[model samples]
Target: MQLPWMSRTDRRHWKSARTTAALGELMAQWLEGSISSRPGYTPRYGPEDETRPLVPTLAALCRAGYVTTCSQPGLVGWGADDAWWEQRAAVEGVVTDPVLLHRLVDAATTAGLLVRTIDYSRNAPGEAPIPVTTRNCETAGEFGGRISEADMAAQWRGLNPDLHDEVSHGTYVIILAPEYGPTGNRLWRILAGSVQEVGHAA
Candidate 1:
């Protein structure tokens, strides 16, 4: 459903509207107590410095200013697990050459991030991490004739077959944006707990 507060044009023009909407629905469900956090995990949204506890409401998320209500035009740099990386590889438009991509990942690692990527060389380390980036998805049917799912899968597998299972369903890439600052311990922690699936509500 379209958010009640959004202008018609805003809904029409937002590139990541669907993703935001989907997340909103999930957040709404959580806020209404329809879903609950699982043990050993406390879910928080919005900016890290905000002291107010998350109230499970969009207003609260908005108020805290971490879980963006609207998609920002620039990259919202974030770290994520293999699932997110896989999803990004399958669909996002930002394609990087393997060698160059590895260099960036190496830089991030040097700066202190435990990122995970597909290892391109057998002699290289087994767990090289891929840096994710934010980019648009291709228009519907744009590549229909050009690339088949099997072909895309093959290409993604080439990026790292061992990573297939983890990133197969995610939707965004993990590239570091200058605007978001360098990947480090803070970003790592955020990624680690950013999305937690709790058990069903009691």
Candidate 2:
């Protein structure tokens, strides 16, 4: 069902729009007390969406302002579990390389972020305790401009695969506007209750 809100010229790979629409359906379901809006809540995407799973929690982030409709008391950014990482990975694009990706992972360990390319090793994570900024994103872009997406998804998944089940996705999202694109895309992996919670939970 093409609701009145969806764009008429949406492309197959246009992730931001696709994600938003799918999430909106979930939000409607959430509002009607459908109550199954879990992190990997991929049960439906209406008639116009591709047959892919979507993490419904992102619906809260799709808006222009901070979300206030969550039944839970805390922000999804600081409260989601490792399972959220896997759910997100299933919906978004992924990394092209793992080893170089981890090297970049070690680079931005301070504010918890990951980049979408092996090439992302050349930049820096900016000032923020939460997932924020693109001051040092891949030279290309997260939307297939140059860099990839899975690299940024790996941060919260972390290094210990035994613990994070989806350790392949890691802990953070990637960086700023680089020379390789029409626009730089940013991915934020606001999962695992932040790095400190991860450390103390151990």
Q: Evaluated with TM-score, which candidate comes out highest?
A: 1
lDDT tens digits, residues 26-130, model 2?
344443434332222232323113111222333332221111121111111211332211011211222323433343345444433333332333444433322
Model 1: per-residue lDDT, tens digit, 100-183? Answer: 334434644555543334222222333333233333332211110222346435433322233332223322223222222232
Query: How many clashes (backbone N, Cα, C below 3 Å) per candidate?
Result: 16, 17
The candidate maximizing lDDT is 1
Off by over 4 Å in 2: 1-54, 64-111, 116-202
Query: Any runs in candidate 1 off by more than 4 Å, and if so which?
Result: 15-103, 117-202
TM-score of each: 0.22, 0.20
C-alpha RMSD for every candidate: 18.3, 18.4
